[model samples]
Structure formats: C-alpha cells, structure tokens
Target: MILHIGQQKSGTTYLQEVLGHVAGPLAETAGILYPASIREVLPDAVESHERATSGLLGTEYPWISAERAADERAKWPRLMARVRAWPGTALLSAEALSTIRSPAVARVAAEFAGAEVAVVVTTRSLDRSLPSLWQQHVRNGRVSTVGEFFDLLARQRDRGPAAIEREHGLHLWRAFALGGLVRRWAAQVGPERVRVVVNPGSPPDLLWRRFATAIGARHCADLPSDDVRTHRAHRGLTHVEAELVLALNRAIGEAGWSRYEGRAIREEILQHGLLPRTDRGPRVAVPMPARKRVAAWAEEDLADLRATGVRVVGNLDELQCSAEPQDVDQPPVAPEEVAQAAAAAIMAVASRDRYAPALRRRGWRARLGSRA
Candidate 1:
C-alpha cells in the first residue's frame, strides 16, 4: 500500500488530482488502486484529528462534534472493506495523516498488516513552505499579519521542539519540521519504508516523477500532467487579498456564522471568488529578514532527515535556500488593492445568491412544462 502523507503545499493537491485522473488506468496496468475518494478509508478518529488541527487555527475551532465522530466511525470499516476487496496495492492520501500520533499510525499499519505498506512524504524548503503555510492559515481564517505569524513561529522555536509541537499544534509543527515528522512516522513504518521527496522549485512535473517512483506507479508517466480542471486551481493569495480575507473572517466570526456558513464563505466567496483572479497581485513570499532564519531551520531539518536513513528521492541541495536576502521587507500592500479584492469577493458572493433562485425557478418551470 502506498500512503501519501502530505507535508502540505508541496504540490500535494496537484498530485492528488493526478492520482485521481489515473486511478483507472494505473489499476488496469500495474494492479495499483488509487481510489477516487481515498479519505473514506481512514479511521474516523484520524479524520477528526485532521479536521480539528489541519487549519492551524488552533484546537478551539469547534469542528469536532458527536455527529462527525459517528460519521468517521462508519467510514473506517467501509474503507477497510474496500481495501480488502481491492486485489492489488491500495493508495490512500491525506496531508493531515502527517499529524496522526504513533498509536494511530500503528492502527493504520495493523489494518493493512498483510499489505506491503510504504509511507511517502513530500517536502519543500522552509523558505517556500513558510509563506505558503501562512497563506493557508489566511485562507482558513487567520487574521495575523505575515510578520506576526513569523513572530509566533520564532517565539515557538525558542520554546524548544516540544513547546513548538504543543503551542503551534501538531499539524503545523509537523509541516514545518519535516524531519521530525518523518521520524514520527518512521518509528512505526520503519525509516527504510519512508520515502522523502525534496521539491525542487522548477519543471512542475519533477515532483510527479519522483512521487510515482516512490509509489511504484511508473505507468503514471503516460497520464496527462497538465491540470485539466475547468476551474482554476487554488493559488497563494496576494498580500493585499490575504489581508482582505482576514478582515472578512473577523466579520464572519463576529456575526457568529455557523461552521457550515463560515466554510461557505471561505470556499465559495474567498476560494472561488478571490483565488481565481490571476490579476489580483503578486504571490506572497517570505520577507527578506525572515529568509535566513527559514533557511537555517530547513538546513537543520535536512540534517535530521539525513540521520534517519530514509530514502531521499531528489537532490538534497534543492531543499536548501541559500539565496541572498532582499534589502527591503515585503512592501505594504496598498489599501486600494485590498479594497478592490474585497469588493470583488463581495460581488461574487452576491451574484451567486442573486442568481440561485432564478436558476431554481427556471428548472421548476421546465419540469412543469414537460408534464403538460
């Protein structure tokens, strides 16, 4: 079994999309089973843990509930049953799996005892990952400025590894400290079975080739690498756009939107509305002052991974960020740009709400006319 445990923002979304695209063809050719809905097979507890902390918004986010627990319990057996039915290697993925405790890892290992299980972890340099990670937090309702976020990280770093794990929560820390994450999973699965793929910042298809190698799915070479979805893939929000989102999140929270309602705003309004606008602004990046620190942390992480004896799939140097820091800090995004993004997002949500009823009425009218 091939398990892709995402360290997040490491082209994981793209990889999952590719895997979904090739599920049938790969199964036919290589006896590989990348199910269309891989998460259905993971235990409910694991799912809950993922949902609770994946956003890096802290554990008080209120996503956990009895209803979700029941649903997850139901899913675990269904996943196992599906795995049992599949005749060949089964592929399961979720970035949140990186945060699972050793006991949960043991449970997953036990569930697939008869199968040859290998864990694949995708990682990138801290320089790349920090900005992406912060942008994700923005998407998920973080209101902290980039400077503030880094400050939190710096303070957490000073408190030691356990403190970092405790304060930032397991999901965020694991993502940042890639080697520590590998160690956690390797303890259960063994270091040799863990495949660490370093993300070189070019030729988008490099990650796929390395990932396919890790999973024994060389047949994926024949599958189309281009993202073929009609909708634009999610991109990092521009600095101004992210600031606007933080304001919206605060408004939504103050208005006391329910979890479902908040998600609708985040996904429908922010994700579909603001994220697709390529003309929005420059992609967010780590400020010059923070780059050196990020690079040092990355070097330490690489050293840890080297010590573990896990299979490294790409050039270790590609994981290093030795670039000279820019002289200026990230420029303050203009208020005008933030206003424009906010206006566009508001309009998108308004348009959807305005047209929805008309579309429903038209559907009803057609159905009634057909009866006549």
Candidate 2:
C-alpha cells in the first residue's frame, strides 16, 4: 500500500484529481489501484479519502458535528475492506493525515501491519507557502489579519512544534515542519519506505510524475498531467478576495451565527460568490522580516531532513527558501477594494441563482431527449 500523506497547498489537489480519474487505466497498465471506493463515499467530489483518514484519526475538525464524524468514522472500515480486497498496489492520499501526532502515526502504521506500506510526502518551499496557508485559515473562518497571522506563527515557532500542535490543531508546522514530520513517520515505517517529493513550481504535473516514480507506477508518469478534469475547489485566494472573506467571517461571528451555519454560508459565498470571479488584486506576499525568518526555518528543517537520509524523489535544492521580499509588507487592505470584492461576490451569487432554473430546465429537456 502507498500512502500519499500530503503537505497541504503543495499541488495536492491536482495530484489527487489525476489519481482518482486514472484509477482504472492505471490499474490495467501498472496494477496500481487508486481505489474507486475512495471517491464512492463522496462521488460528487474527488476529495481523495480525507474523510476516511480523518475518521481514522478521529480528528475533531472545526464545525464538524458528532453525527458527521461518526458517519465518517464508519467509512474507515469500509475503505479498509476495499483495500484488503484489492490484489494490486493500493493508494490512499490525504493531506489531513500529515497533521497526526506520534501516537496517531503508530496507530496508522499498525493498521497496515502486514501490508507493504510506503509513505510519500509532497512538499513545497516555506517562503511560498505562508500566504496560501494564511488564506486557507481565513477560508476556514479565521479573522486574523496577515500581520497578526505572522505574529501568531512567530509565537508558535518560539513555543516549538509540540506546543503548537497541542494548542493549534491545524497549525502549518504540523505538516510543514518537514524534519520533524519525516522523523516521526520514519520511526514508524522505516526511513527507507518514506519518499519526499518536493514541488519544483513549474509545468504543474512535474509533481505527479515524481509521485508516480516514487510509487513504482512509471508507466503513468508521462500521462497527460493537464488533462485530468476536477473541480478547483481549493483555488488560491487573492489579497482583496481574502480580505473580503475574512471580513465576512468576522461579521458572521459577530452576528452570533453558529459555526456550522457560518461554514455553510461562507463556503457558498466562496465557491459560487467569491471564488468564481477573476482574482483581480495583488497576490499575498510575506514581509521582509517574516520572509527571512521562514527562510531560515526552512534551512534548519531541511538540514535536519538531510541528516535522516530519507529517500527524496525530487531535487532538494528546489525546496530551498529563496523568495525575495515584496514591495508591501502585509499592506492594509483598502476598504474600497473590499467593497468592490463584496459587490462582485453578491452579483456572482445573484446571477447563479437567476440562471439556475434555466440550466435545470435545459438539463431536464436533454434528459427527456435522451430517453426519447
């Protein structure tokens, strides 16, 4: 079994999308099955077994109800059953698995006790990942300003990984503290069995090709990396759009909306109302000091990572932190920009509703014609 335990925001969604689509063909050609059951639980989405992995860990993610967690918990066994049934190499990919602690890691290791388990971790440069990480938190209902977010990260850095993991369940370093993460898994699964694939930041599918090589599915390495069709559910948020969403999150909380209700409304606004619009503002950038700090942290982590002698699929030099500081150091988002973004989001939601009935009617007629 190959487990692609991910470092989130590192082209993971793209890779998972490809894996889900090519499961059948890949199985036929290379005897590698990205099991159909992973998608069967959420057939409408190619989320790559996140729920199953979450169930395995019993992670109490924010806003997840007890009923939902139990339902997902039940899926773990069913997923395992399908994996046991498959004769060929089976693959499961989930970014959430990377956040697990040492004990959880051991539990996971024991689950595939008799099976040949190989772990693959996809990573990106720390310099480049900070903005994306912050945006993700904002989307998840954080109202922290970029400066405040970096300040919190600095404090977390001072406290170290254990404290960070204990206090903040989904902190960036839980996954991106590369050296610690590698060491923990290596202890469980053996250093030789774990392969780290570094993001090279180009051509998009390079990550997938390296991933394919790591798992011994070389035939599928050269498959059209661009042709896989999947929803861009976690698209990167731009500066203005992120600020707008952050404001909305704050407003929702202040209005006394329940976390679950806020999440539903927030996601709807993000998917249909905000994300659908073109990203028209400046991209998020780290200030000079924070950039330097993260770059140094990456250096230390990479040094520790090298000492472990874990197998690496791509150039370690690619993971080096060399991002140049941007002109603005966490610039204040303009109120006008926020307003413009809010207006666009409102229009987007309104237009979607306006056309939804017509689109449904067209689909109905098409179905009738097919029946005829």
Candidate 3:
C-alpha cells in the first residue's frame, strides 16, 4: 500500500492531488489515492463525540481534535480494505492522522491493513510551520498573540509545554513534526519501512522523482508534480488579525473556540482574516528560538526513520529536514469558521442579493453589503 502521511498543511493535499495525477497530478506515472470514503462513516462514527463538540466537528471540513479517544478512530477500514484490494500502489492520507499522538493508533492502523506499512511523510521547517500553525491555533481559539503564542510554545521548551497541550489538548510541536510521526509509525511498520517525503522548495519533478524512489512506487513518472501552494489553512491572517483573534481566545479561555450561543465569534474574527495583511505590514523575522528547538528534535527522529530499512526512495538531500520555504499566511478564514460564517453571513448576503437582479444586468456592480 502507498501511504501519503501528513503532518497537515505539508502539501499532503497537493501530494495526493499530484499522486492521483488528478487535474494536476504530481509525477507522470505514480498514482495517489485519497480516503474519500471515510467521510460518510466518519461522521456517524464520531456522532457521539460531535454531540459534545458538534460545532467544532462540522462536516464542512473533516477535522478531529487530539482529544479524540480510541473510540473516535475513523470507520474507514472497510474503505481502506477496498483500496488495498486494488492492484497498484494506494495512497491513503489524512492530516488528522498526523495528530495521532498515541503509539497505539499507529499500530492499530497498520494492523487493520494486515500488512506492513511504508509511511511517506513530507515535512517543512519550523520557521515556515509557525505562521501556518499559529493561525490554526487562533482558529481553534487556542492562541491569541504571535508573541504570546510564541511564549506559550517557548514555555513548552523552558517551563515545559505540557501545560498548554494539557489545556488545549493539541500538540503543535509533535503534530507538526514528520520525524516525530516517523518515530510513532516505525513502531508499527518498523523504522526501515518508514519513508519521509521531503518538502524541498525545489521543482516538483526532482522532488517527486526522489519521493517515488524512496517509496518504491513503480509508476513514479506517471504521477505529476504541483508547484501551486498547498496547506492554505495558514495563508492570510495578519499580525493584527491574528492578535485580535488570539486576544478574544485568551479572554474566553477553555472552550474559547467553541460556539457561544451557537455562534462562532472567534471564527468570525478570523473569517475575513486576510483582508488587512497587506504587503506593507511588519516585516517577517527569523523564527523564534523555540522554533529552532523544535527543529532540533528532527535529527534524532530522522535517525529512527532511517532505521526502518524500508525502501528509501528520494534524494534525502532534497528533502527539508528543517525547512523555511517562506511562511504563507493562513487562509483568510479557518475552515470551520468558513462554514459557520456561511450561516451567519446570510443576512449580509441577503442585503447584497437585493441588487443582484439589477447588477446581473450590470455585472461587477452586484452584491455589496455590511460585511463587504
């Protein structure tokens, strides 16, 4: 089976899209399969959990928090079994799985397939991951300020961060690290079997060529490479917007990201988050020290990765051990917030829609409103 593991926002979608050779495939020959079937049953399986965190568990996007216990594991095994039946290599990927902190989840995932697994995880640098991750934390209402967010993460290193993860129930550090994931998966498939798909800022062809080789896919050339940016969840929140949302979260504290009276207020704070992050904003800085400290863990984790003895496909050099491909802003809206805003935004849309009839005749002049 060809597994495309994701630490999220790490080009997992682009990689899958590339592998599938979809509208824009990655390699010319290789195929990447996504786990679409899981969606249907996943909702039903997690319905109980959703009851407690329904607003956060909306179907507009499939995101499961780390707090999910064993009972929360997805019900896509039957789908995977079908994918496994296929003759060619199958790529099953979910950024959510990247958050599987339990050693057991890794083992059970492999055991369910009744096969040894080859894990292909793509990674980027901490400098790059932060801006993306920070926005996600903001969206979830876990962080409030870039400086303060950095402080929280710094505490993870100095004062020790279990406090935050304890409070927030997510591990920004572990969840975002490929080597850390490799360590977990290695327990199930053996380290020699784990393959790390390098996130080089280079041309996709070269990267894909290397990735396929390490994974032993016969059709590497068949897959396509994508240069378009993936992991858009971290694209556009400006410092001001991020800080505003973070402040709201801080004030709200635990259950901050949760809906207040069925309304996702913090999410609204981030819905149009990219509007003001103009090119003229504060210049970017070198990643904080805590970021580098996180990067430091890769060396040991990677060593464990190589021990798996599985086919090492790509040019390891091309892979980014600790990357900084430039931090793309988080998406203007967090995925879940986008769904929530869609509901609350209808009034704004209604007001604008009134002009649609006349504007449809006028074209570009149509649909302007309160939120516009």
Candidate 4:
C-alpha cells in the first residue's frame, strides 16, 4: 500500500483531487486502488486511531473532545475493515497522518502488515512554507498577524525541538522538521520504503510523476492529465480578505455565536462570499529579518535527511530558498480594504438572496405542475 503522509501546503490537496477524479481509471488500468471513499476514510481513521491511542497512553491532544474521540474510535475499525478488503495496491493520502505519534504509526503499519508499505512525504522549503502555513491557520480562524507568527516561529527555533513539540504542537513542528518526520516513519516502515518528494517550483506535473513512480504504479499514465488542472489550486486569502475574516472571527466569539453559526460565517460569508471577489494579492513572504534564520534551519533539515539516507526524489538544493528578499515587508491591510471586503460580502449575500424567493417559487410551481 502507498501511504502519502503530507507535510501540508505541498500540493497535497491538488494531488488528492486529481487522484480522486481518475481513481476509477487508475484502478482499472494500473491496479492502483485510490477509492474516492479513501479520501474521507483515511483522515478519519488516522485521527480516530491517534485519539484512541493517545487516550490509552494518557496523552492530551489539542482540540480532541471526548465525544469526538469516542466517535472517531468507533469509526476506525470499519475503516480498517475496508482497507483489509481492498484487492490491490491501496493508496491513502492525508496531511493529518504526518503528525501521528510513534505508537499510532506502529498500529497503522501493523494493520497493513502483509502488504508492501511505502510512505511518501511531499515537502517544501521552510522559507516558502512558513507564510503559506500561517495563511492556512488564518483560514481556520487564527488571528495572529504575520509578524507575530514569525516571531513565534523564531522563538521556537531558538529553543530547539523539545520546546517546539511542546509549545507549537505536532502539526506545526513536523512541517518545519522534515528529516525528523521522515525518520519517525522510517523507523517503522524502514528508510528504504520512505520516499521524500521535493516540490520543485515549476513544471507542475513533476510531483505527480514522481509520486506515481514511488508507488510502483507507473501505468497511472493512463489517467487523464487534464484532471490535475481542472481542480482549482487552494489559494490563500489576500491580506485584506484575511484581515476581514480575522475580525469577523473575533466578532463571532464576542457575540457568543454557536459553533454552527460561526462555521457558517467563516465558510459561507468569508470563504464563499468574499474570497472569490478578492484579488490574489502579494504571495506571503517570510519576514525579512527571519529569512536568514529560516534558510539556515532548512539547510540543517536537508543535511539531516541526507544523513539518514532515505530515498529523496528531487535535488536537495531545491529545498533551499533562493528568492531575493522583498524591498519592504508589506504592511497590514488598511481599514479601507477591510471596509471594502465587508461591503462586498454584504452585497454578495444580498445578491444571492435576491433571487432565492423567485427560485423557490419556480421550484414550487414545477412541483405542483408535476403533481397535476
């Protein structure tokens, strides 16, 4: 089985969507089973398994509620049952799986005991990834400014690994410490079976081809190439849009809105409503002061990975940041920009509702005519 454990922001979503679109063809032609259901089941299984084992070990994981833990634990056995039943090489992809502790990793490996298990980690340079990661946190309701986020990362880097694991949490640190992540999986799956694919900046097809080769499913060439482009890249919000969302999150909390309502506001109002209209602003860049520190860390990580001798698909140098620093760091979104986003969001919702009653009436008439 091929298990793609992601260091997020490394094209995992795009790869998953493309794989999902061609899952049937890939199964038929290449004997690769990337069932659409695996997309849903894999993350649940990983999370549930992690939570269950963590509970047994008396470890506390952030955001894991008791009810959620129990629910996930209950769902895991059924998910593994599906995996055990798969007839050919199974492909499972989930970014969350990257953070699974040693015990959970062992458990997952044990479940696929008889099969050939290869672990694929898709990685990007720390300098490039930090900004993207922060943007992701913002999307999920983090309110920290870019400067504050980098400051936290710089402090964590200075304190070293133990502090990083303790303070920053597994997801954040695993992304920064790529070699350590590889070693954790390598200990169980064997270094030979761990493949790290460096994300080159261009010729987008390169990552998928390398992944296909790693999984021993070269016949995946039969799948349509256009499927990759059809899925939109998971773009991060512009500075103005993100600030607006952050402010909105604060308002939701102060208003004592229910979880459902808060989610609707974030997803429906900000993501769906405002995001589409916002221009793709400047790509997030590592703060100028921290660029050197991030590059140094990236160097250390690359050296460590080299020492471990895990199979690396791309040039190690690709992991280094070569881009020149920005002349001046972009400032926070102006109040004017925030106001504009707010106005756009309101108009978007209003426009949608304007047609809603007429659409409902049309649907009702259609249903009545059918009955008559």
What TM-score would every model get versus the actual structure?
0.81, 0.85, 0.59, 0.81
Candidate 2: pairs in clash: none
| Tens digits of lDDT, candidate 4, 102-211 | 66678778877888899999988776677888877877877788778988877766777665445525446655688778887999889999999887756666767776
The runs of at least 3 residues in candidate 1 whose Cα sits more than 4 Å from the true structure, single-residue gaps closed, are: 38-67, 162-168, 225-232, 326-329, 351-372
- Highest lDDT: give the candidate number: 2
lDDT against the true structure, each candidate: 0.71, 0.79, 0.49, 0.71
Ranking by TM-score: 2, 4, 1, 3
Q: Indicate whether candidate 1 or candidate 2 has the larger lDDT.
A: 2
Q: Residue 293 in candidate 3 has what lDDT?
A: 53
Q: How far is candidate 1 from the true structure (C-alpha RMSD, Å)?
A: 7.9
lDDT, candidate 1, equals 0.71
lDDT at residue 26 of model 2 (Cα atoms): 84
How far is 361's C-alpha from truth in model 4 (Å)? 23
Native-to-model Cα distance after best TM-score fit, residue 364 in candidate 2, in Å: 36
What C-alpha lDDT, on a 0 to 100 scale, does residue 20 get in candidate 4? 68
